[model samples]
Target: MKRMLLMGIALLCISCQGIAQEKKEEKKQFPITKTDAEWKAELTNMQYYVLRRAGTERAFSSELLENKDKGTYVCAACETPLFKSKHKFRSGTGWPSFDREIKGNVAFDVDYNIGYARTEEHCATCGGHLGHVFDDGPKKTTGKRHCINGAALKFVPENE
Candidate 1:
């Protein structure tokens, strides 16, 4: 009886571990899936680094930082519409900051790559990493700051 009880408990523990591992390995499917080689061919060095590899660009190095034209920022990898110029605000965070994103165009996930939890943003259609969102934003707006990497985006003027 004791042997049977011990074996049952061990089996339960093993099954529970499998369940947790399965959940962890389950990845979200993006509509714009591509092979890594294809992505490398399509994106520039910085764009691949920031969007595909979840890397950050140097602060204040993005030309989009000073762009004030009425335009839409689209994902560099998939050309998915992301942020609009109208929703953008200068958060002085050395990155292109926006008060909001085009609704349902962006997705969020938690990232602990920096040793702390951060609200990481991704292009909903392509699953390319844009940047992180924070609560410290314009009080008059959504109170959320979508701090995006300019390299991960391509600006399309309103006329286009």
Candidate 2:
């Protein structure tokens, strides 16, 4: 009887761990699934401009800059969670900035075509270009400015 009880407890623990890991794996998937035409139809021209064409939002004009939400910021083009609210800070740079990106959520490519070498960030899932990153950010964190264009992200407030 004692041996059977111990086995059952151990099995329960292993099953719980497996379920937790599967939930995490499911969380890794991107949310939206749409064709290019479908996405174009769903988004406004300005949203498409910034998200697909990599256009920068006019300074001090991004809705995200003023948002005070407790959730993750996902790529407007692909719905992939890129930045968390915990990383947001007021940099006085007229744009929403972050110290880092969600792990494995983005990709960086070296950009040198504009007469200056820079790192350009992009969504790993949909390959949408975000913006450049720099080393001039505050020293408190990683001292790196993700320097994203405000148009590329959409804030999803946490559910209550």
Highest TM-score: give the candidate number. Answer: 1
Inter-residue clash pairs, candidate 2? none
- Model 2 C-alpha lDDT per residue in residues 97-138, reported as the tens digit of each score: 888899898888775658777998988887666777888887
Residue-level error in angstroms, candidate 1, position 17: 8.2
> Each candidate's lDDT (Cα)?
0.93, 0.78
lDDT of 2 at 91: 77
| lDDT digits (tens) for residues 1-160 of candidate 1 | 9999999999998767555234344578999999899999999999999999999999899999999999999999988999999999989899999999999999999887887889999999989999999999999989999999999999999999
For candidate 2, what is the TM-score?
0.71
Candidate 2 weakest lDDT stretch, 10 residues: 20-29
The lDDT of model 1 is 0.93
Candidate 1: C-alpha RMSD after superposition: 3.7
| TM-score, every prediction | 0.85, 0.71
How badly does each model clash, as a count of residue pairs?
0, 0
Highest-scoring model, lDDT: 1
